[model samples]
Target: MTTTPDPGAAGDDRRLHPWSWLFVLIGSVRQFLVPLLVLVIFGGRREDGVQLAVAGVAVAVLALLAVWRYFTYRYRIEGDSLFIRSGLLERSLRQVPFSRIHNVELRQTLLHRLFGVAEVTLESAGGSKPEAQMRVLRMGEALALERLIRHRGHAAGDATAQAPEEDAQTLLALPTAEIVRLGLVSNRGMIVVGAALALASQVMQDNLFRRAFDFVRGEASGYVASFDCGGPSLALAAIALVLLALALLRVFSVLLALVRYHGFRLQAHGRRLTVERGLLARVRSSVSRRRIQAWTLRESVLHRLFRRRSLAIDTAGAQLQGGEGGQSREPPELAPIATPAACDALLQDLLADAAWPPRDWQPLHPRAWLRLWLGDLVVAALLAAALCWHFGAWGLLGLLWLPWGGWLALRHARFAGWHVDARLVAVREGWWSRHWRFAEIDKLQALQLRQSPLDRRFGMASVWLDTAGAGAASPPLRVRHLPEAQARMLYVDLGREIARRRLRW
Candidate 1:
């Protein structure tokens, strides 16, 4: 079954689900959990009776506010704008035009699912926060509102009254096995472990590392005493333990991936693409195809080992939302984990004109390896000097980095290349961990040609292409260590093309 809007009820004001106050209360409590915990822990002290009273008052105030908000908040659709009236003492009315809305997000937690409701957020460009957020709405009502907004409130005759098709064509659907591969390819486990360690260090009064090291040492000493093992055996045992810990972390990562991306599906409805995923807390989000600013295809060493790659796209209004409450700021991934051939097919289907996997990739300057190696050499030298001051002559071993750096630089320079066609400009770089960043020529917002003293000395320069909504995690679309003349030619050509074309976003 699908949501169908009633044409006659378009102008009537609507209240959220009756249980919205409960969700709002839960959210407020979560937001203040830390402060409340602190107060409760200290409240037992004879000298801190005031804190106890304050905590009690705060809880009551929050509950009252949640209920008041539910009673006061009202919204309605008037022509092409969503009109909202809220607040009791400081009354406010907001009108958000449907044309200006860029994103409509529907979130349903486990509790929300039990109640068959969803939280709706309406977002627009250049806003620090969502334009409007409905705490809770019936599943059908939320879907109906989303459909109304998607059509910009201009659906004709029976179109607005009709239900959406239940069997819409799905572009992609990830299975549980693929999610496990994604977890294996990602360093999310390491990231989570590090964050946990950092948090523990902050929360504990003792030096967390010192305590951990002491505990490990005690356990190792006991094991050695019990087994009567030699130093070599102890060393092997330590290595085994380390490996086991890493394995456990990988398992944790797999569990996390399953929880976040379970039943992940991507669907296309006309010019818009929608993604729905999550195990405990379902999220449904969509972005217009035209709002996509840049695209990235990433393949790390692990990804290559698993025969997988991921494709991510940056959309125009994503950066403005700030992703409040620990939510992801990164734009949704088009493909979290897919084979090379699958990735190529998706790109071909989505961006047919640009040509998938350009064959005519132009290499950078022949001497680019020299420039890359020189930079690495200087860094190695500085590190060696710093170590020598601390460890005397023994520290010269730090120079061992030179050979590895030189090899990497040579390989990177050999493989790095750029491609430009009538519709798209793309750059690919890296050796062990590789990625390709590209965008349509019309999506290009800025072009920069940069040269440092070292670059000038090497007679080389770099060109950077900027696009709207570029994510911090994504690599810059830069062609580096190019001959001065070639760099200038590319910069001028791209600049002229960008100037001639109107930016799509």
Candidate 2:
């Protein structure tokens, strides 16, 4: 008789599935609250109460459904594959082999934190979604499963049992002071300020900027009436109030940053990078070293003075866990705030063999500024004319902004350039804020070269770079107004390079 062990029984000894229903039900009820809130806001009391009763019954039904799903859902790891069975009515099944699993992600919500469990997803290299997910596993179980997958994925993705070695070294920690520094350095404060403004606007039923202007007008009127000040004094008082409002807004943003990035830490393992941070709630995420498709470095003029830069990474498989836009494809910040020297050290450690941001810059056409200057001047002139129409002779003062616009155009042109080598390509651009993007030539999916009628007159062509995991709506990088001949040569060279390299994905 042949003897074989059943892999489905592998985790039967210690696995727990009891809490999964609670977690799923909680998420469903949270979503259901929005409609109830709408009913409360707009419906009559009697109608609202009746609707609430109906909602309660509906939620009870959903709870029963969630219970059924929890009972049915089960997972087991055997040999080199994970088998998952879920869904209450349909009874879905997925068997993801270790070779197909690309990334293992662990996520926790507030309830998970309170209950000491987390959700785990096994992402395959297929596309944007995960191949299998196990919700509300005990912390220990989640971590154990993650480690198992990583250990297996490393060996399977490559030919042998070799995987990226894990150093398990802590790379960075944001102490109280550095956390404060991060708040000051990051633009995310804007998110907090934006949310505040949105909430306030909704409550007041008015735009925040308009509300501020009304407040300023009221204060200015009172000052003018009491002090007998002329128009200039009134203008100055109004400006003062506006400035005060702006200063307070800035402070609010910094505080928000402090709350969001508190207790942030970065750790590096052999081929994985992990980030942990949060205030009231905590977030922990991992990025595989091999999955990094590209990186972008960003710095503003203010960021330059502080010697600070932000780095973002693009990865394959699924979208990053958290970022500004909620679009999984957005390149989430890897090092949100850091010095140039620190970034260099971090990159060297993370991407040991990758030649990133090649320093040798090949300049764009000197006349690249021509289009920018003309474009900005046209905009400024249009604005000045509109001001004149509104304010009459005084509107001629608006023309003074022309020089400022001209300077911006000049600055943008000076920083626009690119560098290319056999393995890496670095693109630098921006007017007020500068950004440097680096990508592997082999990673590029496609390239496009085009010329507008104006560009044709100047014998210039624009080149757009396409890479995997970049969303369909926008190309990852663009170089505008390069000499047409050079652009063509670049196009051919890039295509050749893409064809030459072996694509691991």
Output the number of the lDDT-best candidate: 1
Q: Would you give me the overall lDDT of model 1?
A: 0.82
Prediction-by-prediction clash tally: 0, 2
Give RMSD to native, each candidate. Answer: 3.4, 5.3
Model 2 lDDT, full chain set: 0.69
Please list all clashing residue pairs in model 2, or write none if there are none. 165-270, 166-270
lDDT of each: 0.82, 0.69
lDDT of 1 by residue, 86-137 (tens): 9968999999987667677889999999999999888765555788888999
Candidate 2 regions off by >4 Å? 1-17, 155-167, 196-237, 318-330, 396-398, 471-475
Mind giving the per-residue lDDT tens digits that candidate 2 earns over 77-150? 77777878777768876788876665666666666788888777666555445676566777767776665665
Cα RMSD of predicted structure 2 = 5.3
Task: List TM-scores for all candidates, in order.
Answer: 0.91, 0.85
